[model samples]
Target chain A: MKYITHSLVILLSFLIWAGTAHAVEKTSGQSRLPVTESMVNQKFIFIGNLIKRSKTFKNIEAHGDEDVFEDIANVKALYKKAELSVQQGDYEVANNLLNEIVKLVTSITRKESKVTNDQTNSLRYYNERKATIIALMKTFDEITTNEQTANESLEPRRRMVDDFLNQAKSNITNGEVDGAIVNVDKAYDVAIRITIEVRDGITLIRELNFETAKDEYLYEIDRNDSHYFLLDITVKEKKPSAKMLLSIQKLREESDGMRADADNEAKSGNYEAATDILNKSTKNLIRAIRMGGNFIPG
Target chain B: MKSGYWLFILTICLSGSGIAASFAQEYDILHPPLGTEGIYDPENPGIEYLQQPSEALSLLPSSPTGNYVDWVKAMDDSLIEPRASIYGDQIMRAISMDVIMQQTGSMPYVRFPHYDHSLILSCTNCHTAIFLPKKDANPVNMYTILKGEFCGVCHGKVSFPLTDCFRCHSSVRDKRVLDE
Candidate 1:
C-alpha cells in the first residue's frame, strides 16, 4: 500500500508537468501549424510508450504485483498529457490518445462502426475522439468563419448564425459540446465556436460542411475568383444543408410549369413556342440531377 | 469609264446580294428553304442575308457565270483531294475555278466565312455544324481548301484571287506570299 501511494504521487506529478508545458507552448504560438512532421514523430513515441505501459501493466495484474491505484494515476496522467497537447494545437498527440481511447472503449463499441448507445468508458472515449476531431475542425472553421463580414447581402442568415453561436457559447460555458460528445467518437454538436465578421463589398454565402466527400463547397468558394464571400456556418444533422434539395425542388416545379406551358403551346399548334419551351424545360430538368444519384439516388 | 464602272459596280453588288440569297436555297444545305423568311421589321430592320448567293445570279447564261456555276456547284468527287473536305478544295472542284482567272494559289478561299476562328463565327452562331458554332454543315477543311484545290470555287475564281495567300497564312510564317 505504501509503494502504491508513492507511485501515484510520481504519476500525478508527471501528468501535471506535461500539461503545464503544453499550456505554456500554446500562448506563445510556437506549437501551431506548419507543425513539423518530426514534432509529430516525437509525440508518436510518447503515445506508443503509453500503450506499452498499459499492456505491461495488464500483464503484471496476473502476478498480483500490479497496483490499480498507481495504474489509474498513470492513465489520468496520460489524459492530462493529451488535453494539454490538444490545447496547444499538437493534434498528433491528441489523436494518438484517441487511438488508445478507442482501445479503451473497444469492448463497448466492438460491434459497430459508430456507437449510438452510450456506455461508461464509451462516454470517455467519445470525448477524447471529439477533442481530436475538434482540433481538425479548427483549421476549417477559420477558413469559413469570418467570410461573412465581406458579404453584406446575407445579413439575415449571418445574424441567425450569430444568435445560435451565442447560445452555443453558453453551452460551451456549461460544457454542452464536450458533454454530449463525451467518448463516442462522433462529430459533436458542440457550440459553433468559430466566429467571423461580415464586411462590405462581398456578396456570397458559404457554409463549411464536411459531412460527405463529394461536397466541393469549399473548393467552389476558393475557385470563385471575384465579388463573393462566404457565409457563416450552422452545422447540424437534419438541416439538409447545401440548399441542394431546395434548389432541386424549385427546379422541378419550374420545369413542370414549363412543360405545362409547352403542352398548351403544342395543343394550340404553336410549334415554335412548344419547341422553345420544351427545350428550356429539358435543360433545367437535366440540371436537377446529382452525380448519378436521382433516378439515380437521393 | 467612271460611269461605266459605277454601272458595273451596281450590277455586281446588287446581283451579288440577290444571288447570295438564291444560292443558299438552291443547294438546300442547312438554312430554311427559300422565302421562309421572318417578317422584316421596318424600323431598325436587321439585314436579311440568305446566308449564300442566290443560284439565279450565277445562272446568267454567260460563259464566266456558267463556268462559275459549274465550278462552285458541280464538283467531280474524283478530282477532290482524297477525302479532302476542305472548303476551298470543295468549292474549287465543285465550280471548276480553273476556268475563272485560272490562277490557283497555295491557299484558296472556299467559303466567305471560315469557321476556324471566333471573329468569323457568325455562320455557326445558330446553324449547327461539326465542332459546332459552325455555320456551314459541310465545312471544307481549311487546309485542303487553302491548298489551291476543292473549296476554292467562286472565291478563288471570280471573287478574291487565291494568289493573295496572306489573308489566311499571314500569321503563320515569316515569309509573306512573295508573288503578286
Candidate 2:
C-alpha cells in the first residue's frame, strides 16, 4: 500500500510540472505570433508606402530642373538599403534610414530662409553700381559710332558683370553670404576691367577721328569686304601727301592682319577672343588715323 | 486681421500674375526706390524707404541710432497711439512681455516680445498649433527653424525672416544655458 501511495504522489508531481510547462509554452507562443503578425502586416505595409513615395521622388530627382542636390546618390543608396533592411526584419534600421531620407528630401526641396538686413543693403549697392556701369557703357557707345566695336568689345563682359551682380544679390537674399561675397567680387572685377577697356577704346577712337579726318573722309570699312575704301570725294581736290599715304598704308596692313586673326578666332567659336582682337584692331586703325595728321592733297 | 487681409490680396495678385506666393512674399528688408522721389537712389539716408504705405511718415531716421529695443519701443510708442483708433478694441494686449529664451548654448538669449505681434495676431494663432502653452516646452533651434518648424512657420512665410540674429537675440546679457 505504501509503494502505491509513493507512485501516485510521483505521478501527480509529474502531471503538475508538465501542465505548467505547457501553459508557459502556450503563453510564449501566443505572444510571439501577435508580434510577428504586427511587424509583418503593419510595418511592412507602412514601409512599402514609404518605398513607393521614395521611388517617385527618385524619378523626379532623375529628371529634376537642376542638379542642386548633391546627396541624391546617398539618398538612393539609403533607400535601397532601407528596403533590404525592412525585408531582413531590421525595422529599427529601416526606420532610421527612412527618417534620414525624409530629412534630406526636406532640405533639398525646401526654399532656404532669407536672412540679414545687410542683404537688402548689398543688393541695393550692387544694383546701383550696375546702373552706373551701364551708364558708363552707354557713354562709350555714344562716343564710338562704330556699332561693332562698341557692342562686341564690351557687351559680353557687361552682360557677365550684370549676371554676376544679379546672382550675388540672389545669394545675399538667400543668406549665402560667402557665395554672395564671391559673386559680388567677381562682378566688381569684371566691371572694373570692362570699364577700363571701354574707356581706353573710346578715348583712342575719339583722338584718332579728331586727328586722322577718317570720319570726315566718309570712310566706312565693311568687315566682310577685303578692301578698305576711303571715299576720295572729300579729298578729291587735295590728293593725300606721300608720307600720309605711307602711314595710312602701314596702318591698313596692321588692321587687316588683326581682322584676319579675329575672323579665324570667330570661326573657331572664340567670339570673346575675336572681340579682343577686333578691339585691338579698331584701336590700331584709330592710332593710324592720328598718325596721318589730317593729310590732304593741294 | 488687416495683415491677413493684405496677405490674401497679395496671394491673389501673385496667383493671378503666375508668380509663386513665396517669391512675392519674400521682399528685401530695405526696399529699393529708396528716396521719396521715384528714383531708386540707395545712398539716400532719409527714412523714405522705411515708410510703409499704410503708416504715416515716421519721425525715425532710416537708420536709427539707438539700441534695437529702444528703437522698437519708440516705434511702438509713436505708432501704437494712432493705430489704436484703427484697431479699436481689436488690440489683443495693452502691455508687452518678453519670453526670454536661453536654452541653446550656441545662440544669444532671445528676448521675444509680445508688443509688436499682439497688435495683429491673437493667442490661438501660435499657442497650440506651433508652440506649447507652457514655458520651456519648445526646443527652438536654427536647424528646425530653417526647416520651417516652430518660429519658421510664420517667420519665413509671413513675418520677419530669421536671418538677422540681432532681431531676436537682442538681450544685452551673455548668460549661457546648456540644453538638458
Candidate 3:
C-alpha cells in the first residue's frame, strides 16, 4: 500500500507540471496575437472610413470608371485575404497585404495634376483661398480700427492686397483657376504683412493706479510669474555653459526664497511688505533670465 | 511492487513525449521566429534596410540634443528644398521684420521674427487661426504658452520648442548709461 501511494504522488506531480507549462505557452501566444490583430484591424477600418468620406472617391463613382471600381474591388478582396491570414496566425502576410491596400487606395484617390482634372475640386480650392483672403482683410480692418490710427505707410501694401484679390476674382470669372490661385496667394501674402505691421505698432498699456495695496501686490505677482516664465524659456533656448547654469540656478533659488517670504507676508495682511519682497523676487528672476542669454532690463 | 514498476514506466514515456513536443515547437525557416525585422545583409541587399536617423540627417545642422537636426537651418542652407505650396506655381515671398513686445517688466522684451517664419509658411498659417492679427487681442504669457496656447501651438510642437527662450526675447531694454 505504501508503494502504490508513492507512485500515485509522483504521477500527479508530473501531470500538474506539464499542464502549467502548456498553459503558460498558450497564454504568451495569445497575448502576441491581439496586439498585431488589433493594429491591422485599425488600419483596415481607417482606410474604409477614409474611402467613404473622400470627395475624390465620390467623383470617381460619379464618372462610372470601371477600372477604378475594379481596383477598389481588389482592395476589398485582399482585405478578406488579410483577415483570413490573421485568423490562421500568419501576421507577416497579413501586414504585407494591408500595406499593399494602403498604397493602392492612395494611388487611386490622388489627383492627376496639381490643378486637379476635376472642375469641382478646382472650384472648391479657389473658393477656400478667396474666403481666407476675405477673412484676412476683415482682420486687418478690425485691427486698424481698434488702434484708431491712420496707417499711411501701409496704404500701398494694403492697395496691393486689394488689387491682387480683385485680379483673382476676375480670373475665376474667366474660368482660370490656376491663375486665380496665384493671385489669391499674392493677396494673402500682402494682407498678412499689413496685419503684422498693424499689430506690431500696438503695445499693451496697463493702468498703474491701484485701488489698494492688495491690488498692487496682485499686479506684482503677475509680473513675477511672467519673469519666471521668461527665465525658463531663456534657459531652455540658450543651452548655457555649466558655470552660467550654476549662476542662474543660484539666482532662481534666491528668487524662490524671496517669493515664499512674500507669500507669508501676504497671508499676514502686510500687502505693502509682500509687494516689496515680490518685486525683489521678480528682479532676481530677471537677472537669471539675463544670465541665460536674454538681456532683459531689470 | 508491480504497480510501482508500471508507474515508473508511464512517467518515463510521458517525459520522453514532452521532450519530443518541445523539439517539434522549435521554429524552422518556413515559420521563422519574429523579432526586430529587417536585418541588413550586404550580399542579399533586401528592400527593407534599416538606417539610423543620425545617418540620414548627418548633413544637417546639429541641435542642443545631439540626436536632433536643426531643420530650419537645413532649409535655409538650401540643403533641403521643401515645397512652399501644394500648387506648382505659388511663390513664397519671405518678409524680414521683427515685432518687439515691450510689455514685459524686468525681462528682455520678446521679439518675433517674420523672416524665418515666412520662408516656408504662408501668412494664413498663423494669422487669424492661431493668433488674432492684433496686439493685446491675444493674452500671451508664459503660463498660456506652456499650456499650448498662442505661440505654444507651434513653438513647442512642430517648430523649435519653447525651452530656447532667448530666441524670441532678443530685445534689450534701452537704458542710457550715465557718464561716471
**RMSD in order of candidates:** 39.9, 35.0, 17.7
Q: Which candidate is the best by DockQ?
A: 3
lDDT of 1 by residue, A1-298 (tens): 9798567556655555554554454235522344344545455565555545655444434432234335445555666777677678787767676456446434322323233333554554443444433442443344345432324443444354435444544545675554443322113222111111211122121112345322232222121211011000011112334676577567667867876787687678675666567656655554554311222111
* Cα RMSD, model 1: 39.9
Order of candidate numbers by TM-score, starting with the best: 3, 2, 1
Question: Tens digit of lDDT per residue, candidate 3, span B43-152?
Answer: 33222233333334655776753235677788888988878768756667666655566655555667777777877877666765676544456666666777788888
Model 2 complex DockQ against the native: 0.01
CA shift of B49, model 3, Å: 2.6
Cα error, candidate 1, residue B109 (Å): 47
**Candidate 2 residue lDDT tens string, B1-180:** 679657755654544443232223223233322343366454533333254322222333242211112334555566434343364743333225456665322235566765565556544346545665343456565546656888889764665544444667665443332211
Which candidate gets the maximum TM-score versus the true structure? 3
After superposition, candidate 2 runs with Cα above 4 Å error: A1-298, B1-30, B34-74, B80-91, B172-180
- Listed per prediction, chain B TM-scores read 0.20, 0.52, 0.63
Tens-place lDDT per residue, model 3, A51-151, is 56667666655663577788778878887887788779787788788789888877776633233556676676667666667776777777567766546
Better of 1 and 3 by TM-score: 3
Per-residue lDDT for A98-199 in model 2, tens only?
Answer: 668777755654422123335676665555544544554454455445544456767788788779878987886887766876786677556556544544
| C-alpha RMSD over true interface residues, each candidate | 39.3, 36.8, 15.1
Question: How close to the true structure is residue B83 of candidate 1, measured as C-alpha lDDT?
Answer: 29
Task: Score each candidate by Cα lDDT.
Answer: 0.38, 0.52, 0.70
Q: Estimate each model's TM-score.
A: 0.14, 0.24, 0.51
